[model samples]
Target: MKIAVTSKAFAKNETLKSELQSFFPDCRFNTSGRLLNESELIEFLGDCDGAIVAMEQIQAPVLDDVNLLKVIAKFGVGLNNIDLSYCQKNGIPVKWTAGINRQSVAEMALGFMLMLIRNLYTTSNQLKKGEWNKSGGQSLYGKTIGIIGMGHIGQELTHLLKPFACRVLANDVVDINEFCEKNGVVSVGKETIYAEADIISLHTPLNTSTVQFIDATAFHKMTKKPIFINTARGELVNLQDLHDALLNGQLYGAAIDVYDVEPPTHKELISMPNLVCTPHIGGNSAEATLAMGRSAISHLVDSLLGAANER
Candidate 1:
């Protein structure tokens, strides 16, 4: 069987490559180190029987063109980029493993919070420019932390924050009452979180209900003017609205790891002193990369070899 590995990180890993080759023998990796556009991606997967993909959009058009493709095993947790309905309609099974990088993403979110509240980011920048600034900011201890989408990453972050003695306000569409009660997380409404939280972090998936969920109107609801952090999907926040909020002092500041566009082109927004931006490396830790790759490989091997029940 022929298989294509579309994730650059997974493709570059010698261990993962060898492991996949052991099962399939004929495995193609994206070695060019360039993010493939839609046409290029379709062409690359033309002769493959199955693929392990990350971040690439797999919609009806791409699926319709690739007649030989049988299955897709997602390299990461997020499935917003893939059209699940289309895949289901066409009988193409999309195998996925969730929460593989939960701790990695949670740690990044915690780092962002500490950097913003402690004034570490701005002070570091000032020092680099030969300016001495020693202004201290608020402490994370005894602060109200609002967490949206109390899933794996959110739960992990809550656990990490336990030593800090912060109040965790959690909100999720589905019931997480037992877990919240156990962790001392208060189940609250979105409005309450906006008004009360000292720090707000997003951990939700980007779906119809969540795309552009944090817009100008949401910013307007911020009575506390909290420090915002997003380690989740890029489209979850409106970049323009966030920029306006930072400029207008709607919130203290923001640290965003994901953007509407990867390697975002908006210089004005990204260059803001109060805002911190990263190149979507929240789940790219060495350990998380290995775990996610192995999980994707497991799904692919299980699905194709008729061991789906084991998975």
Candidate 2:
């Protein structure tokens, strides 16, 4: 079996290369960075059984080009970057690495929440300009926090928030009754969570229904001015709604780590002062990167080594 790795723009693929070698010794591995066209990716993935991928588009267009492609062991849980339904329909399994970087993502969420509430970014800029203003920060100890998705990352975030003694409200599609009970968090509907939470953090994935899940109407529904935070998919929150919320006093502030676009080719939402933006580095921590890489590669070997099993 030949294993080909399509590299990310600024990501390190060393661990993925080593892990693939460990599983299939006879497999040929080639690392590439410039796959501008679908034909180019097809040429690289020529006879490969499975490929470890990150943030690359594996649509039917690129998928059509590859002949022996079987498994796409994506390095993370989010499948928004790929055409997952098309892959599923064509029997090309898109295996994901889950529960590997939960702690990293949870910690980043906590940091952003605290930063937004305290206005840390603004304070730093003010000090740099030689201004002395003693601003007060709100307490998270007794405030309410709404977590959008109560998955592994959401549960992990609750663990970190517990030290702050926050009342946690969780919203998810499935029955999280037992999960919420064990974690000292209460499960509620999405509308109720949006209306009552002092701080709202998103832990959901990007899907058709969830895209723009928190739009203008959702922002308008938030009764209390919230310290909004989104560490999940960026498309979940409509940028204009958020901008209006900030402009019209509907929101206190926001901390964003992800965007609808990667590397941000667009310029509308990111330039806002109230929103603290990072370079989508939520899962780029040293430990998290290695864990995701190792876990994804392991899944690839399990499903794709023998005969390029689709699932």
Candidate 3:
């Protein structure tokens, strides 16, 4: 059987490359170090039996052309990139594991919180320019933290924050009262969280109801001028609104690791000193990268090789 890996990052990992070859010698890997466009991606998987994908759009058009493709496996947690409806209608099995990178992402959010609170990012940049600004900002200890989604990464963040003794307020669409009670988290409405939190972080999934979840209206509701952090999907927050908030002082500061556009081109927003930006590496830690790659490989191995053995 042939296999194709669409994730450029995953394809570049030598460890993953070696491990995958041991199972299936005939494999295709994306080595361009750039995301393939629709036509390039379709041609790449033209003859593959199974595929490992990340961040590539696997919708009807791509699936329709890849007639030989058997199964689809996810390399990361997010499913918004893949077309589940199309896969389901055609009976294409998609194997995925959630929360594999939970610790890595949660740790990044914690780091962003610390950096934003202490003004580490801003002051460091100033020192680089010989300004020597000594504005040490607030501390993360005993501060109110609002987490928008209390899922795997959110729950893991709560565990990590126990040492800080932060007042954690969480709001989710599902019932989290029991978990909140056990962990000393307060289950509150989104309005209450926006009004009171000293630090606000988003960890929700990207869906219809959650797209543009935070906008100008939500920023205006933040009475505390909170430091904002987004390690989740970038579309969850409006890019223009976020820039305006940081510029108008509606938000104290922001640490953004994800953007609506990868390699985001908004120079005005990216050049802001108060805003710290990172190339979407929330789940790209050395440990997390290997784990996610291995998980995707496992799904493909099971769905194809294991099924072959059973037959």
Candidate 4:
């Protein structure tokens, strides 16, 4: 079977490449070192029987053009990029495993909280610029931490925070009262979390309701002026509001792992002294990358090859 791997990072991994080849030698990998556009993606996926993809949008148009494509296995957790309704309508199988890199992202969120609270990021940058400032920020111990989503990554982060003895206030659309009770978390409304917490972290998925969820209004409700962190989807927060919040002292600090635009060009926002940013590497840890790649490959193998063998 002809297979296409659209994730540039996963394509370049020799370990994953060899493992995939053992199952299906007729595989194509995107070695362009960048994300492919629609035309490029169509050409790359042409006539392939199965595919393992990451971040690339696979809507109805792409699916229509790539008629030979049978099954798709996702390399990461987010499904906002894929048109699930279209895939289901066409009887195409999309295999995806959530929380495959839960620990990696959870760790990064915790790191962001520590960095912002302790003023590690700002101090490090100041030192690099030949400025001496000895402002050691506050500790994470016994602080009120507000977690906006109680999904896989959020749950993992809750577990990680146990050692710090933090007061965790959680908010979710679904019923998580049982989990909150068991974990000593206070399941409260988002507004209560916004008003009371010392630190706020977002882990919700991007959907219609959650798009631009954190705006000026949300920031205004943050009475404690807590440090804010977003390791989840970028579209969930308004970048302009975030920038304004930091500039106007509405927030203590902010840390961003993802952005509305990858390689974000908002110089003013990125250059803020009270903010720390990464190139969306929360789930790209060495261990997480390998695990995510293997899971995708396994899903494709099981769907395409293992099923045929069973038949």
Candidate 5:
């Protein structure tokens, strides 16, 4: 059986690559150090029976074209890039494990909150330019933190914030009353979160309902002019609206790890002094990378090996 690994991070791990090759002798790794485009991905997966993929869009056309593909083991939690409905219809099972990188993402979110509230990011940039600026900022303690999407990452972040003694307002489409009660998180609406939070962090996935979720209308509802942090999907926040919010002081500042485009093309938005940007490394910690890779490999091995026995 042939297996293809589309994640560069997964491919680079010698232990994982060796383990996979031992299991499936015909295993292939992507040597290109960049995210694969749609055509490149389809071509790479052409002769493989199974694949481990990350951040690549797998649509109906790709699925229709690739007949040998039987299973896709997702390297991370998010599934917005895959065409799930099409895969289901065609009997192409997608194996995934959730919360594998929850702690890693939560830690990054916590770091962003601390940096933004303490004005550390701006001060450090100023110091590099030979300017001595002593700007006192607010503490994370006693602040109202609004967390949208109380899933694995959100819940993990709430647990991490316990020492800060901040009030956590959580919102999710599904009911998580038990979890909220246990964690002392206030279950609230989106409007309430926007109006009351001193810092707003997003952890929602990208779907039809949540694409461009934070827009001009949402920004206008910010009564507290909160500092925004998005470690979630990039399309969740509108780039133009975020720029306007910073310009008009609708938000104190923002820490963005994800964007509408990876390696975002918006130079003005990224170059703003008030915004702190990262190249989507929120879940790429060494520990998290190993955990996620192992999980994906487990799913691939289980599904394919089990199916082979059945046949």
Candidate 6:
């Protein structure tokens, strides 16, 4: 059967193609530059029986057009990019690689927390410029870290933070009381987290209700002038509010990997020295990429072989 691996990043990492080919030698893969629009996607999938999608939206419109489309195996766990209910209704099975990069993402968040607390970026720059001035900074030892969303990533992050002996405040929409009790993470309300956290990290999924959860009011209410770390969905925090807070000294600093808009055409926050930005590479390490690719391919293989009985 014909297959299409439609991803902007997949074009660079040719290993996935090799791995898939090894398992299903007869399957043909057509590489597209990126996720295609409705009309473009229809044309691109021409005779493809299955597809590997990354960040593209597979709405009902595109799914309706693909007469031959079967499985839509996503590289990562976020299904918000695709329309799940529509896919289910149409019987076009969709599967996503789950928790493959949990440790990698958690590590990146921990690194960001340390960097932001110590002003490492600024200090490194100053020292390189022949200034040996000692810059006082905050320590992670006793800080209260509020982890919003206690999923795989959040749990891994909690493990990392535990070594530092920092107070962990973990909150989840679902019942993660077992994890909280075992890890000594205090499960609390959203208001308490927003108000008391020394450093706040967001790990929640991007959905209607939680979108822009951290807005101007939330930022204004933070009494600690907390350093914000966001490695998850960017839109969860208001970009305008963040920019305004940094300018007005309401926030200490911010380490952001994701953005409200990807490849932000005009991010005003980039101009602020206190704002450390990365182009959404929290889980883009080589190890993590290979893990996601191999895991997704394995899931597809199992599903096709009628071995995904438990799933």
Residue-wise C-alpha lDDT for candidate 4, range 1-311, written one tens digit per residue: 99999998898899999999999999899998887888887888888999999988888778878888889999989999888999999989999899999999999999999998998988999999999989999999999999999999999999999999999999999999999999999999999999999999999999999999999999999999999999999899999999999999999999998889887878899999999899989999999999999999999988999989999
| Per-model CA lDDT versus the true structure | 0.91, 0.79, 0.93, 0.93, 0.92, 0.82
Candidate 2 residues 1-311, lDDT tens each?
Answer: 77776746223456556666787764543334443456776776778878777666777878877878888887766777788788888888888867777898899999988877877777776789998757857766788999999888999999999889999999998899998888789899988887899999998988878989888898888899898898888888887787778878888888888777666653656777777888877887888888887777777767865454653
Clashing residue pairs found in predicted model 4 = none
Q: Candidates' TM-scores?
A: 0.97, 0.89, 0.99, 0.98, 0.98, 0.92
Instruction: Please estimate how well model 1 matches the true structure, expressed as its whole-model Cα lDDT.
Output: 0.91
Clashing pairs in 1: none
> Where's the lowest-lDDT run of ten residues in candidate 3?
32-41
Residue 266 lDDT, candidate 4, scale 0-100? 83
Candidate 1 lands at a TM-score of 0.97
Write one digit per residue (lDDT tens) for candidate 6, span 209-247: 889988999998888899888998888988888899999
| CA lDDT, candidate 4, residue 226 | 96
Residue-level lDDT of model 5, residues 170-249, one tens digit each, is: 99999989999988999999999999999999999999999998999999999899999999999999999999999899
In candidate 6, stretches whose alpha carbon ends up further than 4 angstroms from where it belongs are: 25-35, 127-133, 305-311
**Residue 133 local lDDT, model 1:** 94
Task: Compare candidates 4 and 6 on TM-score and give the better one.
Answer: 4
Q: Tell me the TM-score of model 5.
A: 0.98
| Evaluation by TM-score, superior candidate among 2 and 5 | 5
If the candidates were sorted by their TM-score against the true structure, best first, what order would they fall in? Answer: 3, 4, 5, 1, 6, 2
